[model samples]
Structure formats: C-alpha cells, structure tokens
Target: MKRFQILFFTAFLFLCANLLFAQINAPSPIPDRVVLNLTENPATSVAITWRTDVSVSEGFCELQPAAEGPLKKEDSKTFKAKTTTIKYEYGDEPVIDANQHSFIFTDLIPGKKYIYRVGASDFWSEWFEYQTPSVENDKFSFIYFGDPQNDLKSQWSRVIRSAYRHAPDCGFMLYCGDLINRAGRDVEWHEWFHAGSFIYGMVPQVMTPGNHDYNDLMLDPHWNAQFTQPTNGPKGLEGTCFVIDYKNLRIISIDSAVDSELENENGYPMQAQKVWLDSVLQANTKKWVIVTTHLPFYSPKENRDNKHLRKHFQPILEKYKVDLVLSGHDHSYGRGRVSDNPQAGHKVMYVVSVSGPKMYEAGDKDWMEHSGADKQLYQLISIDGNELSYQSYTASGELFDEFILNK
Candidate 1:
C-alpha cells in the first residue's frame, strides 16, 4: 500500500510539472488584427494583413474555393506572406517589436467565394471566407462611416457591428478618417482593432487618414505596416490618398489633413493632392464617383470652417460632378448640396458624419438639407444604376435621415 501511494504522488507531481511547462512554452500561432483591403484590382485580387508575436518571423496563407460545407484543406493553394517588423512605442511602455504579415492573392475569380487561413505548421488561424466583387454583380451596396475616433473599444464597437449586421452583403466598408484618437499610440490602435474584431478581416477596408491618424501631418509609420492599400495615388501620398474602382463605382480618397498643414509651412502636400485629383477626375470612366476625406469642406460647427479645404477641394468636386463627398472632423451629422437648389446641374452632395461617442452641436447652414446633433450615426448607401440611396442610422439602429440621389 505504501509503494502504491508513493507512485500516485510521483505521477501527480509529474503531471503538474508538464502542465507548467506547456503553459510557459506553448507555440503562439494565432494571428491578431487580421484585416482585408481592396487591392488595385478588386476583380482579380484581395489584400490581407495580420500581426503576430515576434515568435512568428514568416507565415503563409492557404486559400481554396469556398463551398457551403466544411473547407477542404487538401484543395488549398499556399501563398507566402511578406513580413515586416513593427517597432512601436507608446508613452512609458517598453518599446516592443511585432511582426506584421501581408499577402495579396491575385488571379482570383471575380465574385467567387474563397476561404483562407494564415500561419505555419501546427499553428494556423481558422478558415475565413471572403467573396470578391464581380462585374456580373453590377449593382451593389457599401457601408460608410465617418470617424471612429474616441473610445473605440467601448463606444465605437457596436456602431460598426450594427452596420455589419444591417448590411452583411455589402461589398466593402469605407472609413473617412480618424480611426483612433492618437496617431501612434499602440493601446488606442489595439482598441481600434478589438472594436471591429474579425469583421475587418472579412470586409475589405478603404480608409483615409485623419489628423488624429498622423503625427505633424506625416502618416503614422505603423499605418503602412498594417494596412496594404493601393499605391496608385500621387508620388508621395500612396496609402493615404488613392483611388479604387469597385465594379461600376470609382472611390477616391484624399488626405484633407494636409490642408490644415498648408496654413503652417507644408503647403506642398495639399498642392500635390490637388494636381493628382485633377488628373484622376479627368480620367474617370465609372458611372459613379465618391470622394472621402478627413476634413469637411463645409464645416458643420459654429465658428469652425476649413477654408483651405473648401478652396482647394470644392472646385474639383464641382468640376467632376462628384456624386458624394463623405467627410468627418466636425463630430456631427450634416448633409447638404453645393447649391440649395437640388436641380442645379453642377451640384455635389456633401455629408459630414460621426460614428463614435464624441458629439458636437449641429450648426445652421443654408445649404444643409438635413442635420442632426449629438447623434452617433452610420450610413448605408445603395447604388443601383443611376439611382443612389443613402440612409443614416443612430447607434441604437434608428433611422434618422434618408435621401436618394438620381443621376
């Protein structure tokens, strides 16, 4: 009996020792902050990005045609990911290094469903499915949000989640700017990632930078590391200011933050974007044009006006007959046209909205068709042929404003 008891005690200690060892040295293969971005050609390619701890130096993605049933791993094709080390610092926290991995899958069949997962042997992410935009689906809808700047983890989470729930079939999501409060704060960025969770990984994001997303008008280094956007913009503003053609629609992103810097010393950024905007508008062939930026050309708050933005961008919008100009920075909801008379031939509709907890009082303006104050809202836009439908909903899923623009 004594010998049997001794064996039992010995086995219990051995089990505990192994448990501790496993806890200390388990391989971390899981990826965090997984996101999808529209490549230059959405019909044939998709861009995916994710972050892992330093343990993961290199990773690959396996993709296959998605079906209704479980994913068939045997039929998967592997694509190697490009990895970059991101060294970030925030206040007093020790500077740390993380591996940012990106993979752009090309030659994909348009409008087809594909399942993909990332990682290395024995440590891989669960299969995620995404559908590419197809020319066959000529008519589609997309969700747009102005700014998710403050309290992203607590306040902004439900707004985006609600928008996704409301329009699950939308092709992609467009964020105007001010994704987070601080430019280079990793904690804030971590909250931004956690707020959207896996929704970002599924829906492609086309985001522009707000003043909060930059440090002294220069973009955050971490921005380029995590997001892989089209490099088709002007010479300097590659990721922040670019254009993407999704099906029959052309979406243009501008960095309006540069206009504010124009007053200081760096006026070249705005001038550079101006020249690029003219050339881009001149070459547009899509049926619809939507431009997005951080600053509102027409401010919505009392004693607040972006004079530089208005002087520089409004003319191009008018010249191109742009359908919509979505903007943020006022932290209020306001929509109006270039002219009070909607029947005017060269009018462009402008909208400034907010999707975070922050709120500002709506100021009166003659050009506004609809305005709301202290409301956190998200917009659902549907375009079918020449008719474009726009709807704004409050955070709790209440419709606050609706309009349709017929071309």
Candidate 2:
C-alpha cells in the first residue's frame, strides 16, 4: 500500500510538471478553448471541441479509462478529429483565422471515469478526466446560467467558479444564452473561454444560442462551427435546436428568434420547431423534461414580453407538462408559472435569469413569484429519484433563492 501511494504521488507530480511546461511553452498549434459538449445520449456518448492555430490541419484525440496507476499511452485508443478552418473579417477589423476541431466518442461505459487529450500525435494536450452519465435514474446535479454575455472574464467567471464550488460533480453546465456580448468576435470568445479554462474541458456543456449569438446579417456562422451538438433536430435546425438525454432527464434546446429570422433570412423556423418539439415531447421517457432557450416566454416589463415564443412555445410546453422552462435574454431574474390558480396542478415552472454583469431594471410583476435585477447569479439544480431541488446563488456564493419539487 505504501509503495502504491508513493508511486501515485510521483505520477501526480510528473503530470503537473508536464502541464506547467506545456502552459509556459504554449504554441499556436496547441489546442486552446477545449470544451466537452452534450451528445444525444450522454450516458454512452460525448462530444469534444477545440481550437488551434491554422498551422495544424489534422487533429487527434486519445482516450482511456481513468486509472490510479500510471497513465500509459499504449493503453489509449486514438481517434481522428474533424477540423474546420474558420476565417472572418469583422467590419474593418483584420481578418481572423483559426481552426476548430471536433469529435464524438461513443459506446462509453456508463458511470466510468475516462481520461482523454486532444492535439496532434506529436504534440498532445494534458490529460482531462470526466465520468460518463450512468444509465439509471441516479441523483445528479447541473449548473444553469443566463447570458454570460458581458465582462465574461472579470464578472461572469466568478459566477461559474462559484457554481463549481457548490456542485463540483455536476453532470453538466447549462448556458441559457448570450454567451458573449457580440457574435463572431474572436476577442470576446477568448474572454469567455479564458474565464472557464479547465472547467470547460471537464464538464459537458449544454449551450443554447441567444440573440447576441447572432447579428442582423444572420445567425453567427461560428455557432455551429464551434459546439458539436445533436443533429436530431428538425431539418434546418440541427445543432442549434436539439435534445439531450442524460440519466432520467431530457433537455431540449430551442431557438426562439426563428420566427423573425426564419421569414426574412434562412433560419430555423418556429413552425418546424413546433413539429419537432411535439414529436420529441410525445416520445419523451425521461422523468424530467427541461427546455432551454434564449428568449423568455414572459417578461417582467410589458415591453419585453416575448410574444415570439409565448403564442407558439408556451402552449406546446404547457400541453406537454414540461417540468421547467429555462431561458435568458431578459437580463433579469423571474420564476413562476403562467396561471395563479391553485387548482392548476402539474404546472410548468418558468425561469429567466442572468449571470453576466449587465444590469437591467427588473420591476415587480404579477407573473413573477421572485424577481431581482442587476445581480449576477447562477442556479444549481439537482434531481434525486422523486425529488428535485434548485438553489440560486450570487457571484459571491451567497444563496439568493431556492425551491424543492417532488414527484
């Protein structure tokens, strides 16, 4: 036992030294902004994405089950990564170019820890470890945030870090929308990535596109070029609108700006989404059904009422009896159901929140049970068998709000 402990300690130190050296001598071809994303079936599948300098055309990922002893390269399985060259000339700014690489690992053993790295064979990334979701109704937690869109590196970083400290073993992190202040801006994306460096590599991300994720010209081309999500959505809505099944929970991500964009420009239409959403809801077998989008169905102020989704999505969501409808874009916090009637059992809870430093004047409204403004917050949601608990926390780790739901 003593020998094993000494060997483990030595191996840990060796790994740390290698990581430090890699950071100090980071090269352009070295993978940066590496993130794990949710797949169709997270229990047996996971998607990874990373960026590199255009110098590297080919990319690779090596994976193996996490172990206590030495991590041997001989025991790892190698997979070729798909790389996309992204070049953009934003307005008058100099043209930006970068390579984005993505891969999906499937047939993973449920509930097992896996260590993996991404890069070329000659230059590999430091090992990252994450456990696959179990194939059961197991107790699990996940973090949810709204619009980490402004001052991401300085302000939004703390909210996410606080969420990690509250639930380090969370199955995933759900971003409601507006991940950055501008669409297709490299420097802003850099801030978003740099803020949550290692956390992105470890936990799988659930990203829903917000309005700012696009621009007046069209939806950001980089949206799909970056995150690798499910293609099981409607014909035109692939990665942007999809479903993920993890444990006994089913999550649906929808694009609410479609109604406007779909008519004028080529975009994911609400009608197509309605058909797909109805089908998905009908076939849902998970115990929990949560929907995330960039637009809220209800707004604290009258001017911001999301008629875009209210007329279409609100009815469908209520009909299907979804447990939670989570969204961003409001820049404030509000949580409640539509109706105030007590007899309206099996009501769907609606929540709109923000995690970035952007401030808005949130007024008290009749539809909201709890409302707040100008405060960045994150939510920790846990599901265990028949009980679901939600806790909202401030950037400083103070408990802002909480609630419990029983099945």
Candidate 3:
C-alpha cells in the first residue's frame, strides 16, 4: 500500500511537470497578416492593421529610421506608436465574434523610409519597412486596381503578383472596392492578405468601400474592423467615408452604400455626404482633386447611368472642377473625358477598372476613349509637374492603354 501511494504521487507530480513544460513550450501568437493603408490627410501619416490569433487588449508599434549604411548607436533609436483596439461582434445571439486592432502613425517625415513592427504583450512581430512620399514628390507614382473579389488564393494572387512585378516602384496602391466577395468572411480576408503578400506589408493601400464591402443590410462590421481612415467627413458618415491628401493631390473616398437608394428614407446618407463633399471640394487648397468610389458613374456592366449619383454628385464634381474620378464595380475598363454640362468646357476623366477574375463586355460610347473586355489589368499613374501619365497593363505586363492628362 505504501509503495502504491508513493507511485501515485510520483505520477501526479510528473503530470503537473509535463503540463507546465507544455505551457512554456507553446508558441506565441505572431502577427500572421499585416496591411498598411494610406490616409487622405497627408503623406506624413499611414494606418497599419494586423491580426493575431488571440484577443489583444492593447497593441503598439515601434518605428525606426530605415536608413542605409552601417547601423550606429544613434540610428538604433526607436519611436513607438500606440494602437486602438476595435471590438467586433457577429450573429444574433453573439455566440460567434472576434476583435481587430488598428493604429494610425502620424507626424512622420515625408519621403523618408521607416521600419516598423507590431507587438501585443510579450508577443512581438517581425520588423517591416516602408517609405512615406514627400508632399512635393510630384514625380510620384501609384497602382490602381479594382475588385479582387473571388478565388483569392489562386486567381487573385496572380493579379497581385503581376501588378507587383510590373509596378514595383509604385509608392502606393488603390483598390476601388469589392476586395472580398463577402465583407464579413474571415477566411476571405485572410486570403486577401495572402494574395497580396508580396507588397501588402510594404506598400500603403487606399481602399474605397464597395456594395459588397458592406455586410447584410445595416452592418459593415468587416470594414470597420479592418480599416482606419480620416474621420473628418460629414456627420454619421464615419468610416464609410473619408478623404486623404497626398502631396498636391486630394483623394476623396465615399461610401455609396449609404448614398444608394437601397436604404430607408431616413437613411439617405448621400445628401449629407454631398453637402460635405461640396464643402470639401469648395474648400480644397490642393492643385488636383480625384474622387474614388465603388459604384461607377459610367459603367459598361450593369446600370450605365447611376442616375441618383449622377443627378446629385456629377454637378458638384463639375462645379468644383474636379480633375478625375476613379471607380470600380463595373468589372470592365472605361475612361471618358467629361466636360461639364455637355457644352464642352472644363473636363474630368472618369475611369472604371477591375483587377479580379471577373470580366464584362466593354460598352461602345463616343465619350469612351478606351475600353477593354477580356484581360485582368491594373493601372499605373505617374504624376510629374502638370502632366499626368496613365497606363493600363494586363496581368502579363502588356500595355493595353495609355493616355496623358494635362493640367
């Protein structure tokens, strides 16, 4: 009996020791997915979003000078920024849910490279570096794409890889909308990050919300959880709408979902959005203005005439002498020069493009200077002085269209 008791105690102690060892050997939650988004306020700021396996109550990132040459003591100095933890819940009974964290880094030096890394508690992620463009870098360039909506792993990766290879020098990226078919799908978001794995961690991306970007009526949980942009928009328009100023360019992003007529009478957010847009455009001190959204004002796919939007916003765009309008959702490519009032005066070119596997027949219109029906493509815009050069390239790096916008 004594020996048996001693054996039982030894077994219990061994089991406890094994449990403690297992806990110690367990892996820490590393930052699996990371994304950098550009804010409209200025080129001196950027928004970073990342995900972890467990809930993070608090998070922060350390930024260091990404300067070349040998590292010195002074070069090792670090700057830290705190992140805001955003909570998100889904389903009726609240049984299924998750939390996402984001942070905005501001007051950064433009045209300077900075290295950064995120961490939560004792878990630290790997270091990544990015450069902020100078407000005066008129020679800057960017990549514009639309709708990476379906087959994210296989098809979308090809598009993203092709764009990265062709436009490696692009300072930033713009997604017109429909990044994922369903906004609330965690798996889809994961695939999106994976598809753009090559450039996502390095390049800053500016995204507009699409119809599919929002979840079932009344909720845009995924969008709110993933992105953080300028909130200087109209009342109640918050994340769904915002603006960012890069160099001499002003990029305005609006949520057409709220602006669309699908909402109830009292939920018409477009009126307020337009009122705010008028003020923004009227108050603009920038040299050039570009507006971006998910729905196209001139689509070759679905309803060609976005009647409500055209009726309410087109006049405002023309009235403000807006230079360009970039949009997605048509699943095709269309660019046309618009002269206010059809009288041929001040002109603004509206462009609709798609970057996913989907395709739609290009409409034939006199105003349409160029249109494509079959290839998956991305656009690269280079702005130098008063000249804006636009080039649309296929996934295989073939130049499908080219145009120049003179100021």
Clashes of each: 0, 0, 4
Choose 1 or 3, whichever is better by TM-score. 1
Which one wins by lDDT: 1 or 3? 1
TM-score, structure 1 vs. true: 0.90
Q: Which regions of candidate 2 deviate over 4 angstroms?
A: 1-27, 259-268, 340-346
Tens digit per residue, CA lDDT, model 2, 132-222: 9889787999999999999988888888888888888999999987898888776677788888999999999998888788788466777
lDDT of candidate 1 over 140-192, digit per residue (tens): 99999988999998999999999999998889999988999888877777788
RMSD of each: 5.9, 10.0, 6.5
lDDT of 3 by residue, 144-245 (tens): 897888888888788888888887878888888888887565556767887888477788888877877776555456676666666778777676678787
How much is 81 displaced in model 1, in angstroms?
0.7
Residue ranges of candidate 3 with Cα displaced over 4 Å: 1-28, 67-98, 259-267
Instruction: List where candidate 1 sits over 4 angstroms from the true fold.
Output: 1-29, 259-261, 264-266, 339-345
The ten-residue window of minimal lDDT in model 3 covers: 90-99
Error of 3 at 238 (Å): 1.7
